[model samples]
Target: MSKMFWLSCCVVLATCFFQMPTISAGSRVHRVRRIVGGAPAQVPPADDPKVYLRFAGKAAQIKGVLDQPHYVFRGIRYGLKPSGKDRFQRPRQYFLEGDIDATLYPPPCLQTIPGDGRVIGSEDCLFLNVFTPDLPDGTEGLPVVIWIHGGGFRYGSASQYGVRNLVGKQLVIVPIQYRLGTLGFLSTGTPELPGNAALWDMALAVQWVRNYIGYFGGNPHRIVVMGQGSGASSALMVALSNIAKGSISAVVAMSGTAISNWAVENAPMITAREIAEYHGCPTTSAMILLKCLQNVNAEIIAEGDTILERTRLTNRGFVTGLNGMLGAAPNAEGRFDGRSLPAAIEQPPMDDMTQGNIPKIPILTGITRDETKRAVESQYQSEIIEKLKGIPNFMDQVLIKNLQNCTHINDAAKNGTKQSGGYFNLLNPLQFRNYLKIARNNFIQGLSKIAEATNDALFNLPAFLTADLWSKKGVESYLYRFDHISQNKNGFGHLFLRGLPIIGNNTAELNDTVSHGDDLAFIFEARNLDGSAMDPPPVLSEEDLKVCDEYTRIIAEFARTGKITIDKKPVEKFSGSNFIQIAKKPKANNNFRFCEMALWAGLADRLKSSTCQFLNALDTTVKSAENLFFDTVAPAQKNIGQGLADTQKAIGNTAQKINPLNLFNRKPATPKTKTN
Candidate 1:
């Protein structure tokens, strides 16, 4: 490493900043919730009765907490650290150079997760953790599920979820941590700062597993790549990497797909430029911008953008949902001299089966009942209501506008200037016709309509589209819709964390909203680092544990064999059905939609309109304030009126400032949820 690199490292430690953020365009913008007191100290290893693991002619002591039936080996280095001279380049392998100390997780890649103002993790944070069962003797090559955690592309680490529940099924579970935000994703679309380093981070980590997992008792050949939310996006992308073609045997892209508009960053160059300018980095050229960020304090580079560090896209200080996926994305700017859009991942994840460009592998993809509930929380604010009203077609967009709140517009206003000759209804039509009257009157009701439309357009339909594409391509594709509302307060099960049936009646909860990521808590046994050292680990709710059992078993079955059968029932694939609902019986359901979301997504895909395009335009439109420390969105939107009015006005004023004209006016998606 160069002397200047070492000196810069010293300065970074000297500055000792906390909580970082991400790079240009839709990166996972963090609005972390800070916890009081310092991070609890880690418990020392047990009595030095060393547990050694040897693989590839190299050996290291196993690292992880030893709970019964499973051992979690954490913070195992799998690739060269993306630091010093190697920073911004594609990840390289980093074999064990000394005795492996796999104890506490290595610092997470430097980025904001759970917003707290304290410098966290390191740049050299490329690591993977394994959770293996204390299986019977001679139990070699156990089926493996490689997990990728979701936090948009800006947040999350392998430590976010646990494989303890998974290993209970006698499957090896590996959760890998790659770079996040600007560090793993920032690129200039040229040889100097080519992007998709984040994807390569996963590719290299998988390669490491293929090379060394046997040492930890994982099956190299039967690897099943799995993820939820953005992690699911990564899982789908990893299968597309040239290096991971054979290494990844099957995939479970939960709650996301290969084609979600939020999947890829369409304009990394401009995003990079914007981030550089925001931080006062040398933005003269991509080379200068790359070097300036490299030499700058890593903390500053990660947390510098006041616009992002302090912004929360929603009401609850930023959490994962399709709406929050407005930042950071995978890029077509291939690593090094590789293809701009590689053959493996070239086709948009939303393509039809005949569109081609997919890795030939068994795949399972699905979504939740109300994936937009969490996203809709942000749309309820008065200013957003005003903005939604500004669009003459807002009502058309939110047709199922609270099917609960029925509305009527009398004959006098019915034929009024609502068409362009306009009011709220547009070319798109729906049964819920009186959308304009409801939106004009009730705030929550109107927001609900928009949320439903946006959710269907962004998440659910895209999920259906990609899964259907796999089935069309003749891949072993399974589709599921999580309907049990018992765990709606925290997650969307099957595709996310975990869920449980109600004590006696396991039906969708009427009052419960099955928000996104609610499924995370049920699937993995996450140990809360938020608690004090003396506090006990989170007690599992009966429903949570039960659902974990169901989901883990289903995942294990697919990991081992490419198909799933839960409750002694054969879960039908998407080819033969609309979807298999993840309930007690787990049966198929074809009559799914109640609104025009699939209509919206299909229109989006047809018109080539996507989240990436809309979000990219916001870079110029949305201005930032300050408090990124408390809420991820504190900077961009301290006040609701200031947050969106400025955004809409900026766009209206400077659409030409951005490279692409007609930023908001673009093709809409008409997602085909069924094969026909």
Candidate 2:
């Protein structure tokens, strides 16, 4: 949708393993042999009423530590261990037996840590955790939120986020664990090795929730699927599946979307072949590849995943993910004819979105102002510098390809040989060269502009495009820009990417820095990989706390009612490019990065009287609508209390105050007090 839709997954791969040293266990003991990954499950006293629950005709002795009025059930099995023979396949549902322990944090899915490439996590990891405020016995149940944790679809687990903030709002929060990397998404473009095992794992978790969430006081029909980074797009992918039909009521895709460039793998077969060859498996046939990989040690696959990254980087000259944010990710399955199972992603997300093939449910999607700011400066610095070494070649090879894809330029126009001066030939070739100069020069200074451009290409533009496309298709799509930076310098990105490289290492500028996944810090509690609370827990000032409360309230309200209202005003949907700027005090705004999006959309050359008249006309109308809303509609709402005489007086003066030049530059209207 956002044609230049590189999208915001830059941080998913780079920052996913920032905290690896602390997470990777030094001992080789299998996690399943113990009670849980972290401290042993604290069993409740013999007759504690709050420590028992029955569901699916079986009893579970749930373990929990009190956080005021909420109860958390940790390490609940939703599916059997996707290991050994079951590797790289759909999750097998695990039903609770007579008595089960749901007390400790489950082991995370095995994967290689980002920085040192050391492997952490376990293969026997397919579990979920539940957090609830109450266990109702009545017919009515609390709205449910199925949170899919984001690790660029490579790393992370259910225990990474705490539930105190959300569960306290009377929500039933279920964070489920799924397969990652090669084990989760390797495919050979055949039924013998169909990909998207991670997506299937997610679908099965959703099914588990729909079938048994009620036992924990949750309404299956009111489930809201939400996630950050890779999880965000994964949530949308799950909702689009026929398997998950009628299970998800709404979606909250925070930083990523179904159409984000990094959301799906384009060269799955090649990726699978490469992974197979790296692990010493023959890629002559899919069946052989699958069999050999199935028997290979899980750690070797996780370690060999870096081979995919190195090959893609040397071959493509880009370094964010091995392919797209991870070694293996979701892929379109419709290309194959004979499939043994239903496809999770039938086609590319952009195609599905363009065809209006989205779930008929309200969607809340958006991006952080500086989505990949840290990512570009940190994880991608060396690669970007290498590309900059040969600017012209890099531009011709990578940036130009991106430009062509975004503009949908034809082959003839791309060559710039056949066509004279025309709109299809990038309208003005000089302007394109000038843009490159600016980017190159800016990167020479620091990573700030590079980060900004990366954010626009990857995160900002895609989010806007997703909202625009979904809104056009009769879906209620609400968008927002999270601009608030907490006093503690805390954020989902900051927590995960902490202790890593910083662009300037200037703590004073934290108030201005908002990275991808930052908004989640305000809604969910941050925790260690083992589900233990942060030692010296993060502290928020009173002001920060208020913002946290407001942020969480907005999410809870959206789950309860599809409408999202910030302050007392209803947020306008993205059909008109309207979005709320979330801050200490939220305010509605329009035309998010309009000129920049236009430049990226290849409409810059057509901004004047040219071939793209329809787009120009639409742009003009959008400006007029902004003026009309503030000058007419907005004033009317404020003046209504002044009786008919005062309202009519305001309307009469509206015409004289109108000015096109000042339309786009106006700040939010300040309330004025009339003389008594």
On the 0 to 100 scale, the lDDT of residue 538 in model 1 is 48
Q: Write the per-residue lDDT of candidate 1 for residues 79-102, one digit (tens) a residue.
A: 876876677778888766456666
Candidate 1 achieves a global lDDT of 0.57
Segments of candidate 1 deviating more than 4 angstroms:
1-65, 113-116, 309-322, 334-354, 378-380, 388-392, 397-442, 487-510, 529-540, 594-598, 601-676
Q: Flag clash pairs in model 2.
A: 7-458, 7-459, 8-458
56 Cα displacement, candidate 2 (Å): 5.6
lDDT of 2 by residue, 569-656 (tens): 7777676457878888877887677645544444434344354343343343332221100111223335433432332222111112
Could you tell me the lDDT of residue 352 within candidate 1? 20
On the 0 to 100 scale, the lDDT of residue 533 in model 1 is: 28
Cα TM-score per model = 0.71, 0.75
lDDT of 2 at 545: 74
Q: With candidate 1 superimposed using the best TM-score fit, by how many Å does residue 555's alpha carbon deviate from the native?
A: 1.3
Which 10 consecutive residues of model 1 have the lowest summed lDDT? 498-507
Give each model's whole-structure lDDT: 0.57, 0.66
- What lDDT score is found at residue 131 in candidate 1? 77
